[model samples]
Target: MSETRKCMVCGQIFKLRAQCPHQRYCSNRDCQRERKAQWQKLKVKSDPDYRENQRRAQTRWSELHPDYWRRYRDMHQAYKERNREQQRVRNSQSRQVAKMDVSVLDSRLCSGLYVLTHAVCGDVAKIGAWIVHLTVISDLPVESLKIAKR
Candidate 1:
């Protein structure tokens, strides 16, 4: 009978039934998974051959299972929904930024700091705080306003 060992992942006492003498993890599903993941991480860091082998294996698997990702996406509706939600948030943020720029330009035009030129009469008028009220006298169209030369 093997001596009881402390599980490194969960800190639980477990009896070792496996023949491996260096088994530091318990037979619990979560503990075993963590152990395998930790080992793989260390192996990949220290061993270049193992890392290359793993990469090759993944590439080969992907090549053989070309439709695997499609099937996974079809089966996992939550992933698709989450992706769509993130995309919508990104789009809304970009649209808000564009709208802010346009609104700033509109405010500048409405402030009347610029000069307005009459299209029909070819007359120029300074559109200041009180001067905009006299646009009818100058006969200047709204689209005829241009920045005054300082």
Candidate 2:
């Protein structure tokens, strides 16, 4: 009986092929693709000639199909919408705003009670807002104070 080994890519047990002794990845399409991708990544990082060849091939392909992505997006409405939504999420995450309690940079605000409301619908600090953790002790009307919560 042939010896069995675990596939490196998917961690599945696979019988060692008689033809290929050093097969580390499974025969699954995704695993094969991942193996190729890893090999290409290492090749590109280590071999300048391979990197240049890949770049040239990409440039050639781009030249041949200048509007490929535009046509693809037009044809695949769901893909375009999904990409737009993902980009919005990325933009929100990348915005230069704090995700935690606001740092007390300036001592301009008075030492009094305050309320902090969400700048937007959700409590995310990717956008600008004055926030701090607040506890209302007095029966102050809802018309008062800056608050930040962790």
Q: At residue 93, give the lDDT of candidate 1.
A: 68
The clash tally of candidate 2 reads 9
* Model 1: lowest-lDDT 10 consecutive positions: 125-134
- Report the lDDT tens digits of candidate 1 across residue range 1-150: 768889999999988776787789988999999999999999999999999999999999999999998899899999988988999999986754323213233432333333445344323232321212223333355356664679
Candidate 2 runs further than 4 Å off: 85-150
Give, for candidate 2, the lowest lDDT window spanning 10 residues. Answer: 117-126
Best by TM-score: 2
Give the TM-score (vs. native) of candidate 1. Answer: 0.52
The clash count of every prediction, one per candidate, is: 0, 9
User: lDDT tens digits, residues 1-150, model 2?
Assistant: 998999888999998889999989889999999999999999999999999999999999999999999999999999999999999999987765565445754465445555565343455535555555454454444357345668
Shift of residue 120 alpha carbon in model 2, Å: 34
Residue 46 lDDT, candidate 2, scale 0-100: 100
